[model samples]
Structures are given as structure tokens and as C-alpha cells.
Target: MTARIRSVNVGASRDGVGSRGRASAIDKQPVASVEVRDPGPKRGGLGSGVVGDDVVSRRHHGGSSQAVYAVAREELDHWGGVLERVLPDGQFGENLTTQGLDVDGAVVGERWRVGSALLEVTGPRIPCATFGAWMGERGWVRRFTERGRTGAYLAVVEPGTVSTGDVVEVLERPAHGIVVPRVFRALCGDLEAADEVLGARVLDAQHHAELERSVARRTP
Candidate 1:
């Protein structure tokens, strides 16, 4: 299969979709197309980089460094088999459900041209209480983290439109070779790998804060 977006999804803010009964936009639905752009910093910025998509919480979701979320259809399928459920595109709250791309294997700072937008691989999606609640599987957070196929968070480097069936092309990759899954593991508890994450200059400097914070937590 060609590297392409199988679906573009967006969700509106909704009640009871977040941790502690807070609002969330996790139940994304397919859309024909959407516009993507930098949403500025996490606080005091637009909610979602994809226009019309609502990110109810800005505390740790949606921003320039996480302007978009993309997940591999293959990964979704694999999880579906393990979970014994039919997982649809965007079921994981990813904005783009992609085929024929290694979302988790993508190196940090790798750039892709999705439709007309230039997006950079910023980091992996970290499982959270909201995500666990959304999944409704017992120990969902722990299970997902342990599996470590966390997909990718992308930052829009060039504003443009994206649509289902649009080509997804890798334009560049950093030689540092730190991939999304490795980064996830590092952030989780891999102290040695966490050092790599903190020390890698090839990684996006804009996202270094989070990596550093994670490492700091495990430091002492």
C-alpha cells in the first residue's frame, strides 16, 4: 500500500471524556479534510492545530510541538487483534490514520510532507489517565506503555490542508536515530535511554523541556 492518510479525524469538546470527569475531544470522527498549522505554545494558544478540532485541555495537550497526532493503520490493526475488537481509523484519537508508514519508528526531528503541510516528528504519545479512560480497558495505561507502540505526535512546520488519501512523504530524517518507541521507553523508566533523550541535540529543541522533565523525575 502506498503511504497515505487513510482518514483525517477531528473531534469537538465533549463531557465525561477526560480524566476526573473533565471535558475532552478523544472521540474523533472522520472528516474529508482539515487545515493544519502551528497552534503556538501549550498555554495561551489555540486548542488544536487542526482547525475545528477541539482540544479541551491545554495543560498538556495540543500545541506547536504537538500540532498533530498520526498513527499507523497497521499498529491499529495489531492492537485490534490483541484486543479482539475492530479498531477503526482515528480510534486512538489520532488526527491522521496512516497506512504504509512507520509512525513509531520515525526518528525525532524527521519531517514529512502530508498533503501540503510539512510536519515534524516531535515525540511519542504518552498514555495518560484521559486516554486510559477513553479506552476503558483495565490497566490500559500500563498495557499501552509496556507495549510501547505509542504512535507519534507531529508539529506542523508548514501550514496547509490535509485530507484522506493524501500522500504522506518523509522529506527528511535526523541521523540521531532516536525513534518514537525508544523515546517512549526512555520517558517511561529507561534511565539509560532517558539520558540519550536528554542529550540528543538532533531532537527538536522545542520539545526538550518535556524530555528533560521526564529525566529529572527519574534522576533521584
Candidate 2:
């Protein structure tokens, strides 16, 4: 089957699993349809690109660079086997649960036409404490990082609606070959991977700053 959205998900913030009750929408629920648009900046601007998708933690996630998150259904199934639990659609807070796409291998700067929206590849979805807490697994963050499947964040290039089964077609891709896996490895302290991913000119300014600090802090 061709790459397509198996489900579109969105969620509102829920209490607990964080300090100061830092609400999270990581437990997203599948939706029949939703609108996608550029959410502009993080703080003052709208947090989520998908209408009604809450991004409560503006200090960290959401914004133009991370307007949407996609994870492959194949990857979720793999994790299900690893964790010995049935992973459901939107289990990882992904806005789109995709089928037949090598999401982590998508190069930075790649453009995809999904539904009526045009989306651009941005960066890897980094793991955080809240995510680990939600999973209820020991060393969940480290485990997720070590597994090297960070998924992919995307920015909406054109405002449009998306729904389940929308085909995800690659409209364009840069020659740099800096895919999401390499970028995620860089974020996880792989020095050589850092150099390779940073070589891609398409790395956005916001992501560039985060990558630099993460690489430096993780490097021994």
C-alpha cells in the first residue's frame, strides 16, 4: 500500500504527569478530520498547527517548525512488540499515524503533499520527561533515544484539511540527504551524526539552536 495517513489525531491538555501540573496532550485521540496551518511562533502565536490540537507546553513544543508530528504505523507495531503491549493510533501523540512511509528516513527540507495541505519536513521529535512518565517504562527516554526512532516533525506550508487515509506524497526533497534519523542521532550526542545533520542547509534556526546545545551537552 502507498503511504497514507491511517488516522488523524488531536488532543487537549490533561492534568498530572508533570510538575506544576504541566498539562500534556501526548495522549492524543483519533479524529475524523482536522485543519492544518502554520502556527507561527511558539509563545504568543498559536501552539498547534492543527486546529484544536492543544500544545500546552509552549516553553518547549509546538510552533511553525513543529506544527505537526507523524509516526509510521510500522514503527508503532515494532514498539508494541518490544514493549509487549498493543500500541494504538495516536499512542505516541503523533498527529498523523502513517502507513507505508519511512518517516524517520525522510530528509530534512523534504516537502509532502498530504490531503489539501503542503507540509515540509522539519526535525526529529525529541523525547522528554513527560513522555517517559506517560509510557510508564523504566528509563523510557533513554530507551526511546537508544532505539533511534525519533519520528518526524513537520511544518505546514499551506493551510488545508486532512483526514484519515489521505495519501502522503513527496512533493520535493533537498539534495543534502540529512534525514530525520541522522538528526535524531545528533540530538542524542552522536558527534559524527551531528556534523552530518548540521551540514544540511535546510535546518531551521530554531532547530539549529536546539541541536547545538543538545550535542554539546551530551558530548563527553
Candidate 3:
């Protein structure tokens, strides 16, 4: 089946939500349409799904490397089955909820054509304390990390408008085999595995630096 966007969700930063001590855009709601664009360097990073979308914490979130986060509907379904509950799109705070895509298997630097925008897979979304709070489940972060199905973070390569049901086309895939799951495990579990992904030239500099730091810390 051809991969496609199931929903486009976005939200603004507000007070009293998540573990951020403020409302997080992580609680994204589906929208009919949203403008996708690079916010430009002057704006602090790549723009998110919609014009009013918020990036509450610039310290750890947002930026070109994580401009847009995407999660697979298949994974959501799997989780729903495991939890015996309905898992909705945007429940994980992803900007794009996609269908028919192996998001975790996508290699870093793979370019996806969604609507008119071109997006490059940059890295995986690491579950955080805020995510655990959002989920309202004990050990949610540990459970998510252990599963190693973290979704992909994308960087806008060609900005354009995107909407629900837009077909996602793979325009390019980097020769490097630095898939999302591998990177997530390397970042969160095996520090030694970081080298393989760092070798991928197409990886975003920021992400590369992060992996480098991880490797350095474990090199002693």
C-alpha cells in the first residue's frame, strides 16, 4: 500500500500541560489543513506543521533536525491492541500521523515527498519525561524506549502546504543504512552503535553532534 498522511495535527504552547510546566504542542489536534514551511534560521529553527504551532522548549525540541515528527498508524494500532484501547492519531505528539509507512525502518536522510513538501528523515523522537506525563502511564518512557519503535523526526527540505490524506512518496533514500530504530537504540541504549549512523553524511549536523557526544562520553 502506498504510504499516506492520515492526519495533520498542530497545537500552540500554553500553560499547565505535560511535564514542561506549560501546555505542550505534543497534545496536537487534527486539522483540516496546515502550511508546511521552513521557519528559517532567523526564526530559531525549521517551522512546524502550522503557522501557529508552538515549540515550548527550544532547549530540547524544535529546530531543523526535528521540524516535524511523524508516527506510523500501524505502530499506533499495534499499541492500541497491546493496551486494549483506541490509539488516536497525534496521541504521541507527532505532527503527522502516517499510514502504510515503516517509519522506524526509514533510513536517516531518506527524503519523503508529502504533498508538495520534501522532508528528510533526520532522527528518531526520544521519549521524554514530558511524554510520560502526557501518556499518564507509569514507566511509559521506559516502555517506549525498550520497544525501540520511536518514530522519525523530519527536516523540511522543500516547504509547501500539506493536508490529511496526502500521499507520501519516497523521492530518495540515502545509501547509508542508518535506520531510525537503529539510531534510537544507539542513542538510548548502545552507545557503540552510534558510529554507524554518524558515518552517514546526510545526517543533520545537530543530530550528528549529539551522537558524537554520546560516543565521546562512553569512550573512556
Candidate 4:
């Protein structure tokens, strides 16, 4: 199967897990069409998170580097097998559930032309506590991190509407070998590997800073 969008999901306001009473937009549903644009900075910003998508936590999500998150259907299937359940599209709270795409293998600076918009791969989606809560699984964060198939987070280079069935065309790939999985591995425990991502010229500035900090902490 060719690499194409199987679903476009947008989040809505909903109650979160645990006793925090926090609102979460993790329960995204498939949408027919939605606008894609840059969500600016991480804190106190608005960007492309779908027309009706709710970004409850701006501090760590929904920024230019994370304007969109995508996961391969194949990866979802793998997780389903491990979890012993039929994983549905958007179950990971991904904006795009892609088929026949190696999202984890995509180079950090790679550009994908989906529909009328252009998006650049920035990094991997590091599994967080909220993600674990949503999955309602034990040790999900560690399991997901060790799996190293964290999918890809993308930045919008050109605003446009995208929907299911849109062909994902790779417009460019960085010369550096810093792919999404490598970055995920680096963030998980191998900080030295982050040097590879630091070499990508087209990497998002925000991600660059975070990786730089991680690298600095180990430098002594």
C-alpha cells in the first residue's frame, strides 16, 4: 500500500484520567477535513491543531514542533498485538494515522507534502504520563519508550486542508541520518545519540534547544 492518510483526527474537550480533574484532548475522532498551520510557540500560542481540536495542555503539546503527530498503522497493529486488543485509528491520539509510511524511520528534517500542505518532520512523540493514562495500561510509558516506535511530530511549513486518503509525498530528506526513532532513543536514555539530530540543518529551533540541553547535561 502507498503511504497515505488513513484518518485525520481532531481532539475535543474531555475529562482526563486519574484524580487530577484535568481536561484532556487526547480522545481525537476522525475528521473529514481540517486546516493545518503553525501553532507558534509551545506556551500561550495558537496554531494548527485542527479547526475544532482542543489543546488542553499548551506547555508540552501543540506547538510549532508538535503541530501535528502521526503514527503508522503498522506500528499501531504491533502495539495491538502486544496489548491483545484491536487498536483503532487515532487511538494513540495521533492527528494522522498513516498507512505504508515509516514514520519512525523518517529523517528529522524530511518534508512531506500531504494534500495541499507541506510539513516537516521535527522529532518523535515521547510517550508521556497522559498518554499512559489514556492507554490505561501499566508501565506504558516505559514499554512505549523501550519499543522506540514513537511516531513522528511534524511542523507545518504551509497551511492547507488535509483529510483521509491524502497521499503523503516526501518532498525532501535531510543529508544527516537523524531519523525519528534515533531521536526517540536519544531522549529515552542515549543522550550521546542526540548529536546526530543536532546536525540536521532543517530541524525545528525548539527541538534543537531541547536536544542541545540534553547533550549539555552529559557533557562533563
Q: Each candidate: how many clashes?
A: 0, 0, 1, 1
Q: Whole-model Cα lDDT per candidate?
A: 0.89, 0.89, 0.82, 0.84
State the lDDT of candidate 1 residue by residue for 1-220, as single tens digits. Answer: 6799999999998898878887889999999999999999889999789999998778879988888999999999998998999998988999999999989889999999988899999888888899999888889999999889999999999999999999999989988999988888777779888888878854456556766877777677
Clashing pairs in 3: 39-47
Question: What would the TM-score be for candidate 3 when compared with the true structure?
Answer: 0.93
Tell me the deviation in Å of residue 39 in model 2: 0.3
Which of the numbered candidates is closest to the native, going by highest TM-score?
1
Q: Please estimate how well model 1 matches the true structure, expressed as its whole-model Cα lDDT.
A: 0.89
Kindly list the per-residue Cα lDDT of model 2 for residues 1-220, writing each as its tens digit.
Answer: 7999999999888898554456788889998999999999998989999999999888789999999999999999999999999999998889999999999989988999999999999988989988887888888888898888878999999999999999999989888888888888777778898877766646789778777787778767
Candidate 4 segments whose C-alpha is farther than 4 A from its true place:
none
Model 3 per-residue lDDT tens digits across residues 3-105: 9999988977766677857567678889976777765542556446356678877777877777888999999998888778898899998889999999998
Winner on lDDT between 1 and 3 is 1
Error of 1 at 116 (Å): 1.0
41-113: candidate 4 lDDT, tens digit per residue:
8787784445677787777788888899999999999999999999899999899999999998899879999
How much RMSD separates candidate 4 from the native structure? 1.7
Q: What's the residue-level lDDT of 178 in candidate 2?
A: 85
Colliding residue pairs in candidate 4: 39-47
For model 4, the run of ten residues with the poorest summed lDDT: 195-204
Q: What is the C-alpha RMSD of each candidate to the true structure, in Å?
A: 1.5, 1.9, 1.9, 1.7
